[model samples]
Target: MVWLTMFYLSSMIFLAFFSFFCLLSSFFSILFDVSYFIEWDILGINSNFLVMTLILDWMSLMFMSFVSFIASMVLFYSGGYMSGDVNINRFIYLVLAFVLSMIFLIISPNLVSILLGWDGLGLVSYVLVIYYQNEKSANAGMLTALSNRIGDVAILLAISIFGYYGGWNFYFYTDLIEEDSFKILVTLIILAAMTKSAQIPFSAWLPAAMAAPTPVSALVHSSTLVTAGVYLLIRFSAALEGSAAQTTLLLISSLTMFMAGLGANFEYDLKKIIALSTLSQLGVMMSILSLGYPNLAFFHLLSHALFKALLFMCAGAVIHNMKDYQDIRLMGSLVNQMPLTTFCLNLANLALCGMPFLAGFYSKDLILEIALMSSINMIIFFLYFIATGLTVCYTFRLIYYTLTGDYNLHSLSSVTDESYIMTSPMLSLGVGAIFGGALLSWLIFPTPYMICMSLFMKTLALSVSIMGGVLGYLFNFMVVNYSLNSLYFFNYIIYVGSMWFMPFLSTYPTSKSILVMGSMYTKVSDFGWSEFYGGQGIYKVSMSVSNSLQLVQNNSFKVYMLSFIIWVVMIYICI
Candidate 1:
């Protein structure tokens, strides 16, 4: 225990120091408008160079700082959360390794080097997701791993394509590639990004991955794993400008945004709701990136990381105190029991809802305004606003269910806000959740984005947010004589509540057919025809021949002479 404490403290301090250093370096890089690319050539084959590359620019530095900072806090928080577990040390190391993978991913522009980090993130995350060693965690881990493998394959294919050129560094070759090759490369990269980011059809893994421990959830969902895709797209955004793939990404991301927000509104699992919210925010970032604003997407990514981490940590605290009960329906009036956690939770939720001046407001609101200004079709436009409203709706619903009602847990429940280790990290991140947005906006953008819209257009977001909040709260409110209205729309509720049956779609249909085919193959090949004609038939023929030869050998010269006389007699008779 003492060693574990020391390890956590030392790791936290180490990461914190580096985070500050990186932040300062990022500021300097931005101030000077400078970027440094360092490359080491490892090998050359047929004029194609295999090199390790590192990029030191404002973007990489800033993202590194945020990742490091959040990781430090999560590690600190885990010391308290996992203190009783025997394998705390293993958890800490895995998390640190996860952070290291993310760092490698942030700095490397070469596809070859990036795969080092990319695959590391996927492999480590699967291990972490299944850390609980349960069937659910195992299943979730498999889903997460398989979903991400698609992206890894895409990256590998991309590297192969880049090999046709002189180098694997996409930075140097993105614009130089011919149109046909560029489209193929861009499509591969988008497929990769989509899988990593958990866009529609690939999104089941994101919520399923919540089976991981909360600290891992806080890290993986917020900074390390999911954001890898968005970061990759941001790096490639220059090449992605004005392409057909970009339009497709816009449609997909918009649908993802809308789907996640709608699903969150109906979710009961507290962590799953938060996970859906993360998906929603990722959709926002991708959609804005698709609109050709990588900086804005990046801005939202950093800001979202802050509050989302806080949100997950707070959720962890609640789950921890509630004795691992994650159903929000069983939690109510938590403010009385754990005011500090409730406060931090509310702050994170409000920031998520894009409450004015909070971390989400600066980036999220700006994205909305800029998107409205862009010349997108009406479907994309409505999806954006409706999704925005859904964000607030689900948030308010979560707030109502978890914080503002009668204490719904048993009377003997021992929930308290006394753990300094846990609360301290929440407090530290609460500051970020509050001020990180304005600070990020000022630092990331030299000049504020110009807004020119009519009064009605300007107020639409605010109006929708207000309406959504009221409806979210009122809809969840209960009275003694109240009937179960949702039951009347049972099928509809189930359809919408279950992420539009996405979990089923992603898992059952494909797996069912594949599993059935495998069973068939096993029956026919292993037990039926192959057993009869392959192993059994070969063994029988070989054994029969061996027995005849053995009989002849046993009979020795007598049997040989008898057989020769029999053959001679048979020949004479034939003649």
Candidate 2:
């Protein structure tokens, strides 16, 4: 136990210090308008050199600071959260490895190095997801691993394409690649990004991945794994500028944002609700990036990382105290018992809803205004606003269920601020959740984005947010006997609640037919047709022939002479 404590403290302190150093470096890089690219030639094939490259720009440095900061807090928090487990050391090691992989990804501009990090993330995340060693964890891990594998394959294909173009440093070749090849490269990169970021068709894993330990979820969902995709696209955003791919990305991301928000509203699991919110925010980042505002996306990514990690940590604390019951229906009036935790939870939730002047407000509000100004189709615009409203709606809904309602857990349950170890991290992140956005905005942008929209357009985001919050709180208000109106629209609720049945769509439907076909093949080839035409048929034929020959032999001289006479007569006729 003493050793574990030392391990946690040392790791946390080292990471915190590193985070600060990176932050300082980011400021210096930004002030000087300079980027450092350090490359070492590892192998050479003619003119094409396989090199290990590291990029230290303001962007990479800033992201590294955020990741390290979050990881530090998460590691510290895990010390308390996993205190009872025997394999806490293993957990700590896995989390550290996860952070290292993310760092590798953040620093590398080369595709080869990025792949090393990318595959590391996928592998480590799968192990973390299945850390609990249960059926749910196993299933979730498989989904997460397999979903990310699609992205890995995309990256590998992209590497091969890059090899054809003579280098793996995509940063240098983004503008130089030919039009047709650029399109293919962009598509592969986008696909890889989509899978990692858990965009549509690839989103089920994000929520399912909540099966991981809360600290792992806090780290993975917030900064390390899911954001890898968005970060990758941000790096490749230059190639995407003014391309048809951006339009497709915009549509897909908008739909993803809308879908996640709507799904969160219907979800009852506390962690799952938060996971869905992460998905929704990911969509927001992706949508903004697709609109040719990679800076805004990066800003949001940094800001969201702070608050989302806080949100997951708060959820972890609640789950930790409530005897592992994650159903929000069983939680209520938490503020009465756990004020500090409840306060942090509310703060994170508000940040998520873009409450004025919070971290989310700085980034989310700008993105919305800029998106409003963009020349997008009505459908995409509608999706953007509706998705934003849904985000607020679900945030308020979660707040009402888990924070404000009547206490629904057993009378004997002891739910309080567990320890300073947990609360300290929450408080630290609470500060970030509140101020991280404004600070990031100042650092990331030299000048503020100029907004020139009509009064109605200016107020539209606020209005929808207000309306969504009111509806969210009011819709869940129940008296002594409230009829379950949701049952009336059961199918619709199930469809939307289940992320348009995405979990089923991603897993079952795609494989169901194939599995059925496989079953048919098994029956036909192995049991029915193969029995007659394959080894079984040959064996049966041989057995019948041998039985006849044995019977003829059993008939002694008479049968043998008769068979010989018949064979001789047939031979004579042939002659």
Highest TM-score model number: 1
Q: Give the alpha-carbon lDDT of every model.
A: 0.93, 0.92
Model 2 is weakest, by summed lDDT over 10 consecutive residues, at 478-487
**Candidate 1 RMSD to the correct structure:** 2.8
lDDT string, candidate 1, 1-575, tens digits? 77777888999999999999999999999998999999998998889888889999999999999999999999989979998888988998999999999999999999999999999999999999999999999999999999999999999998888887778888877666447887798899999999999998899999999999999999988898999999999999988987899999999999999999999988889999999999999999999999999999999999999999999999999999999999998999999999999999999999999999999999988999999899999999999999999999999999989999767899899999999999999999999999999999999987877899999889999999999999888887655114776578889879988988988988897689988999999998999999999999999999999999989779688888999999999999999
Name model 2 segments beyond 4 Å from true: 478-482, 516-575
Alpha-carbon deviation at 465 in model 2, angstroms: 0.5
For model 2, state the Cα shift of residue 292 in Å. Answer: 0.3
lDDT of 2 by residue, 157-252 (tens): 999888988899988887764479878988999999999999998999999999999999999878999999999999998999878888999999
Error of 2 at 508 (Å): 1.1
